[model samples]
Target: MRKQMIDSVSKVIAENENTSLFLVDIGVWGFRDVLKNYSERAINCGIFEDGMISIAAGMSLSGITPFIYGISPFILGRAYDQLKLDFCYQKLAGNFITTGAAYDFSKLGYSHYCPEDIELARTMPGLEFIAAGTPKEFEILFNSTWNDGNPTYYRLSNYCNKFDAKVAFGKAAVIKKGSKGVVIAVSTMLDSVIEACGDEDVTILYYTTLVPFDGITLRENLVNEKILLCEPHFEGALLPAIIDSVKDCAVKIKCVGVPRKINRNYGTKIEKDICFGLIDKDIRLEIRKFFNN
Candidate 1:
């Protein structure tokens, strides 16, 4: 997936003279060698995330399209003020691509854990968020929205769904149709959601774009008043959208995601998943409980 982004962005930089790439120490390794050919446009900005956002905003003001790449927590969480004031508040356009979705770096502890990235991003008005579940999805979303002149957040994960469904900007794909309830899976949670819902009478919706929540398709495919939201990030991230979309109807929503609490443990992501009840068996149990109600 990193290769796909690097290759695609390299092509964009080579062709478009107004485009530039900024790396925040994390992407320096993979991007350093490729950026050698375009030394003037691409640069490693070290670990100054807040400063980097300001630089990208300035570049945007100068008519240069800046693509900033870094780890999830540092890029989004650490420099959030810069992102809000420089890019979002100023209405400037840039692409903020992040690696390490949620707890992908669980072994490294809470410094690298960022389950609230989506929640923070959605607060900034007009910002688009895309959680790419596969390399193909990232390539497609990047190509479609990179030059759209909106501040877009692309969350890349070390763990991705095995299959690549057709994805688009602000659109949800219906993976299955049923009459029991609706299961909306976001990014890396799709595979687990599918495995948990095997043969269940539920409609599955694969959601890649988080910010511009595709509620239209969700409303149109309502099989029941029950909704199960499977998100890779913090729980209730999509609750507002869910309620707004089904405003005319009375709906019941059950969310399975990272708990809204501080996690002090350090281990693999799977261990965290077990602790948070995000595993397939636990998800299945939750689904059954939801249905029984």
Candidate 2:
């Protein structure tokens, strides 16, 4: 997915002269060569995440569309004030493409993890959030919104789902239809949610673009009152949207996602998932509890 993002960045740079790429010395591995080829266009902004965001805001003001790429935790967590003030506060337009979704860098410890990015994004008004679960989806979403002149956040996950719903901006893909209940899978959690669901008579709604959530579709497909929301970020980050979508109905909503707390373990991302009870078996148990109760 990083490769796809780099390729997309290259394509956008080759096509548009006003576009620029900013990195805080993080994406050097995949983007080193590209940076060299377009040194003037792509810059390695060192480890100064807040300064990078301020610079991006300036560039945006000067008719340049900056695509800032960096680790999720630092870019968002470290420079949140810059993001909220420089970008969203000023209504400045730019693209924030981040890696290390949730616990993707689990072995690197808590400093590398960012489970609250979505919640932070939700606080910043006019900032659109798109969490791509696959290389193809990243390509599509990035191409479609790179130059939209809106403060957009693109989350590239290390993990991906096997299926592609040909996702679009601000739209949810209905993967399966059933009368039992509804399981809303956000970003990369679709595969596990599907696997955990097994052969249950339930509807699965896949979400790639989450900010401008397709509540209309969700409202139309509330086959049953039971709803299970599975995401890769902090639990209940997308809950308000669900509640708004089903405002008229008494829906039983359950969330399966990363807990909003510190993770001190070091291992693989899968191990982190196991620790959080976000694996298939645990999610299945949650699903059963949501339905049976």
Candidate 3:
């Protein structure tokens, strides 16, 4: 996990001398001591989320590329205006490396939680969203989207666990083949989805990139037009993307994710998962009903 960030950030900065890295007060979790390796271009903006985003925008406008790192909620929710104008409006390029994705920080309460980040980021036009669920996905997508002219958000989780899953940028990977139905698992939720489907004859699709999603492949691979879409995000994060993919078909899609209600529930990630109906049994029930009915 550390190697992915260190190596990828080092390479991006090395290749682009005009780029800089910014951090909020929460750098310890995401960057660690490795950020000092790029001290020359580091901007530790303390806890001023909006200020840091505006400054990064200013820097980008002056022909400099800025890579901002911080918690997901603050980065996307707080500085949304600057993100919309400075980067999106000006058509400038910048990168956001965010942690505490979904409920990864649920124990920290709603202030630290980011269950709606994907839904919020989806509102911004032309922003590419990548959820590098596993370490391997991090290496490939982070490197692929680094230092581009377009704006991108790289949502992350604290889990350093590695998976053998090879995720294409926009295309969905079919982990298993099934004639019964298909399951679309987004990023980190792939593990739980795998466990939930255990030994069941069902097709599973994995996605990293949310925007510009390969809905074409998603539609083509639908065996029964019955999709059990799983995500560790809010209600409509990937719902629209899937809808766009299977618009023409009579696809019956049932999503398994956090509820679309007040998320006042606070606890550890596992507790929050259970509170939000993200357990394996819930997923299995959803899948069973989707395929059976």
Clashing pairs in 3: none
Question: Estimated TM-score per prediction?
Answer: 0.97, 0.97, 0.92
| Candidate achieving higher lDDT, 1 or 3 | 1
Per-residue alpha-carbon lDDT of candidate 1 for residues 83-102, written as tens digits (9 for 90 to 100): 89898888888999888889
- Which lDDT value does model 2 have at 60? 96
Model 3 ranges with Cα > 4 A deviation = 28-38, 160-162
Relative to the unseen true structure, what is the C-alpha lDDT of residue 75 in candidate 1, on a scale of 0 to 100? 83
Residues forming the 10-long window of minimal summed lDDT in candidate 3: 26-35
- Runs of candidate 1 with Cα error greater than 4 angstroms are none
The true-versus-predicted C-alpha distance at residue 87 of model 3, in Å, is 0.8
Model 1, residue 129: C-alpha shift (Å): 0.3
Worst lDDT run of 10 residues, candidate 2, spans 25-34
| Sort order, TM-score high to low | 1, 2, 3
Each candidate: RMSD to true structure? 1.1, 1.2, 2.0
TM-score of candidate 1 to 2 decimals: 0.97
Cα lDDT tens digits for candidate 3, 208-254: 88876888778778887788889888865788878888888897778
Per-residue lDDT over 1-293 for candidate 2, one digit per residue giving the tens place of the 0 to 100 score: 88889888878876888988998887787787768878898898788999889999999999999999999988888988988999898998899989999988888888888899998888888889999889999888888887888899999887888867678898898888988889999999988998999988899999999888899989888987989999899999999989988999999888888988887889899988998888899999998888766
Q: Where in model 2 is the C-alpha error above 4 Å? A: none
